[model samples]
Target chain A: MKKPEPVGAVKHRRDTVLSAIVSQIPYIRFLGVSFDRHGDELTATMAYHPDLIGNPMLPALHGGATASFLEITAIVGLTWASLWEDMEAGNIDVGTVQQGALLLPKTIDFTVDYLRAGLPRDAYARAVLNRSGRRYASVHVEGWQDNRQRLFAQATGHFLMPPRDAKH
Target chain B: MEDLADGMAVISMPYDEALIGDPVTKVIHGGAVSALMDTAGGAAVMAHPRAGVGTATLDLRIDYMRSATPGQRITATATCYHVTRSVAFVRATACDEDGDLPVATATGAFTVIPGKSKT
Candidate 1:
């Protein structure tokens, strides 16, 4: 009988998947944002900086920062889901994937609801995928801080999937 | 932001490598454009003749009409189209060098600050 892959190997592959995809995007890094992976899902985190404050009186985070975070979380979630399939089927070379082979999904449209001012503090967001079809995908993302149940902002996003064969 | 008059505002962002979304094409990320529009929308609402003390985004919807031309500055223009007792409605568009063709368009509703006015 053939033995299954070792846990360490699986962990290494998981790490590779995230690093390869996340490292290539400069905006994510420029915003000081990061993702924590759980299985195939990703939760994005952005640290608070005085530079992010928009309203001096309320000291709230800029709406642009909130929008970027939500949209980025949705894109990363959609991209990772697509690649996980290839990785599982053993169709992807980890080395090739790391060589800037990943393509960021295009935003077709996005809607954001600002429930409350984003307090000047660290924030967290999770993308709940609605659909991940080959041609298009949609995601609903929620952002919160301190209390997960209390969302400061939420968004619904639609994305155009990248062509797999690079012919498009 | 500038030209905040008659319930309208304009804001612009120059091309920045850090704002690029697609590493291959070098197109700026749509999120950056969204932010520009959002700020412009807020400025428009505050500049409205019936303006308020402060405004916050209630909801915003954005459509990406096309990819922004890389290495070009993008400008957003917002107009506060309507205002109610508690809400202000705004529409905004972002364009690069190609002014005729918009890179994105947005419509949003913002809270109408009570007891505030431009006059």
Candidate 2:
């Protein structure tokens, strides 16, 4: 058997596959959700555009647009975290991380609280995995624009994942 | 000049490439569904008897009952359930051509600005 690639190498491959999957998502593509890593956390950024306005009066970002951005961020964060955790535990078979990320988790539920109207500007969101159980994962996500101290929205979502032992 | 019914609105969106979440599966993205529901909810608020000059979404909860079928128009019908001094409650369901089952359902609260703000 060929030698297994290093975890770093596997991660690079996984990122490429995952990014491609995310890009193919039409809404994500239209909204321009981009991912970046700072230290150890991932941040999702959405560029402001005129098409995202729902209320022409305040010229605010559509509530659905904000909610969707947070939701996508949380889902993507969970996917990466799950893959990495599985790999670190040696539970993930070699050459399967990419496939794992491709199999997007099914969203079980989503809730969003619009704290304030999102202005017409670039928006950012960060998601934290609160709990990763055997069959389900929960994530909390917050979105902000212009100033990080003032959040535009907050959301929580649950997604269905396969059991730890199940094949990807 | 035509008059529309009160507290009721319907929004229809076709399944296009821009709404697809998975190109391979050709399924509509959940976010697009949420946007559709939100827009419909806002429209209902606009048509309400007690509609304020303006409104904003306060909270929304969405349940994805199923993925919308590929290449089918998805429509959301929203009705304002109640309106108080400061809030309006709206519930909506999105469905494709597949009978009575809904692709998704959402319940949301909207902030009703009783009158136009002078600011």
Q: Please name the candidate that would achieve the greatest DockQ relative to the true structure.
A: 1
The residue pairs found clashing in candidate 1 are none
The interface RMSD value for candidate 2 stands at: 2.2
Best by lDDT: 1
Summarize candidate 1's per-residue lDDT along A1-168 as a digit string, tens digits: 978988888878978878888887878887788999877778899999887777888989888889988998888888888888778666778887788867778999999999999998899999988988878898999999989999999999899988878711
lDDT of 2 by residue, A26-130 (tens): 677887888876534788999888988988889999998988898889877876676665554556554544342355667777999999999989999999989
Clashes of each: 0, 0
Q: What value does DockQ give for candidate 1?
A: 0.82
Every candidate's TM-score, chain A alone: 0.94, 0.80
User: Which lDDT value does model 1 have at A96?
Assistant: 74
Docking level of model 1: high
lDDT of 1 by residue, B15-90 (tens): 9999977777888888889899999999998888787878888999999999999899999999999998789999
